[model samples]
Target: MAIQRRGFIAAVGTGGAVGLAGCTGLGDDTGDSDNTGPEISGETLTLTTTTSTYDTGLLDELNAPFEDRYGVTVVTVAQGTGAALETARNGDSDVVMVHARSLEDEFMEDGFGVNRRDLMFNDFVIVGNSDDPAGVGGEEDIEAALTAIADAESEFVSRGDNSGTHTKELELWDAAGLTIEEFGEWYIDGGGGMGEILNQASMQEAYTLADRGTYLDMQDEIDLEIHVEGPVKDGPDELMNTYGIVAVNPAVHEHVNYDLAMAYIGYITSVEGQDIIESYTSAGEQLFFAEALSEDPEFQQYVPEGWGSSTDDE
Candidate 1:
């Protein structure tokens, strides 16, 4: 059974708010004659999303207008990307908003998700002590920066909870040809979320990977500085972090609320939702860049990144 919450905010309108799959120029009102879109049956939407969205407070802003327009309560569960997907796999969530594309691909491939759409994007940064103990400041290449950190044996904090940031950190280490198992006391497994990991790094004066939004939101409270920038600051493409929304496949879980899930997905990818995300800021700095309204979205927007070619080969 889905956990229910009543946070609905009634809006002043009698039109449809759901957006199309392609999501072009759609908002609260699409100027239709009847203005009555598909009937949504549910009153509560369970959204399992990553901690960065919740930590940066973007989720509340994004969900407010959505809840108001639909008159439905949005119960959000903020966890790691891995955990969020796992929750959906157990039929506990109606939709999932997350990063870490590789894990998302696995989930969709396993028939647990559908209608995956490119929602928004941000980048990950490598932060450490301001003194630059590893001497990796301003490094454009993430892999090279990781290699430098490893070579210096710098005390690095890892988000060992397998969050999106942790996934990116592991990928960077692998790209640099380094293994986590070989590391000694220099590596600290921070089995926590982004905010907790950032706080841990600050207390220990160690290095860690963090999303730009969370880092900026807590920048004043933490002593660490960004040693390597992400794509948001003209950094390498490897650091680019793209987020997507996937509706749990109703075929697998008959109890899932597919209509409400599609409505939520449509609204977020629509113009209004994109505007809300692009305008959101932490410490007066833009936290995310909207990607759904792009002129030419990749094939991966609706499916896995390489699903086409993989199917051709098979």
Candidate 2:
């Protein structure tokens, strides 16, 4: 069920890697109606996004102004990038915001979604106890760090929910010449959000891969510290975490609101939207870079007709 809130969006960061919440702004009566409850206005738009956005409170910050200006009640179902893409594939959401490029490409190629646009980027970090049991602290190479953690059996937590971070973690492990199936007792399949897995790691005093922003936001609540911060650019691409927004193809589900979804896709890549993302910070540090503003060919994509952002009309 969607969490109903007045102008404020509720914190639905949860386990199981999937949850739906709704934020109604000025004069918004639309809710995440199961269609059993009161029928919401046609202005309601559904956004299936990643847990990173919610855990870092960036979703609330970015979506609040969108709701306020458009008077659209944004019904959000947050899940891992994989699960969120699955939601869009099942025709259960209007838009999908996630970071797994391979999965996102698969979805688009298979005709499950359209209008994919690169929005922002952040890097992944390996974090663990202050004691650095895995000896991964200050490590420059992610694969080597994972090798150390696996070799030492340093009690690691894997988001195993197949989120973007989890995907990257697995890739790193494979590159480290190890398979998750080979992981010993030190490895745990954390079937939850980033915050949940981090909490578990904190309780177990284990190590885990995490997004920089969420970890920073929850540092006080957890004992984990950044053991490694991959460069968002000028480093190996595996370390980069680029987020994208896509409109769920209505052809797959006629019930979906394609127009509103396109509107959101447009809004997120717009100059104003990019500015909002750029301004958001945690602990006095910018959490995400507005990649939409970058002319990087890899970040360029097709924006909906009449909706491409003025920031970087790529």
Candidate 3:
């Protein structure tokens, strides 16, 4: 299915402060409304964030403890970064947690958002079968690895769903001077979310790029090994994969819960929030690394003095 940009905006209007009592299915109703319960007079907030964080089970760890401490409930709508950003732009969501730095900057520059803050980060990796048919294993350079994959005509599954992850992958391929047209047959655009793309890659025994967090979370279900990592895995100047949070500008859309949204952003960037992100792990492996907001020079260029730390590890 094509990513639903409009549905994301509409979904934000449906949020409430109630904690989901069960494993609410991805598309299930969230039980939120204007007068369904107590007015959002307290600290409860709604967040529209990326599917990568949600799929990897990081948000739950961050939100559960936060709700108890702040007497607030965080209702999250997990979608592509573009969708999440659109939701914020439309004032359907209070805050947005997303990875596409360039897009996030545009959102802020366009006045759809404010108080854009840097949060935690993780890297993306190229995974493949143990046999390494594409011979990309252990390659320290991403461009070279991708070139080898294209030259070898190995199966490469792509999440063509226009997600932040997908956007990053396309950027890397473009940077390699290898257009999608040049590697047509070998590339399989899964056109889905991260988890589904990983599943397809495992089934095909193909090479695919994935965020470290999602791959670690679903590692048990796949046989692929991390063939490329570190700078090659999205931490060089070009591959830096940063995640940020922004509160939608109340001026753009009146329905946004501005105070609650800012609170969510503030809490996520706070020492306690960073601590929660640092402590999140899957299968004994750390999913994300916290970058001190106070220490980053690039963060200073985009954010105010006390917004929060931004992570560009990926």
The numbered model that scores best in TM-score is: 1
Q: Which residue pairs clash in candidate 1? A: none
How much is the lDDT of residue 139 in candidate 2?
Answer: 78
Query: Which numbered prediction scores highest in lDDT against the true structure?
Result: 1
TM-score of 1: 0.88
**lDDT at position 281, candidate 2:** 88
Angstrom error at residue 304, model 1: 1.2
Selected candidate, larger TM-score, 2 vs 3: 2
Candidate 3's C-alpha runs over 4 A off are 1-44, 232-238, 295-314
At residue 112, give the lDDT of candidate 3.
90
Residue 264 local lDDT, model 2: 67
Model 3 TM-score (2 dp) = 0.79
- lDDT string for model 2 (164-193, tens) is 998888888888899888667888998999
Model 1 per-residue lDDT tens digits across residues 1-314: 12121222223242544465633332244556664455443378899999999999999999988777766789999999999999999999999999999999999999999999888888888998999898999987778889988999999999998778888889889999999999989999989999999999999999999998899999999998998988777888888888989999999999987878888888887777877887899778989878777545566678877777857787
TM-scores for candidates 1 onward, in order? 0.88, 0.80, 0.79
What is the C-alpha local distance difference test score of each model? 0.84, 0.76, 0.73
Q: Give the higher-lDDT candidate: 1 or 2.
A: 1
- Position 249, candidate 2: lDDT: 79
lDDT of 3 at 153: 91
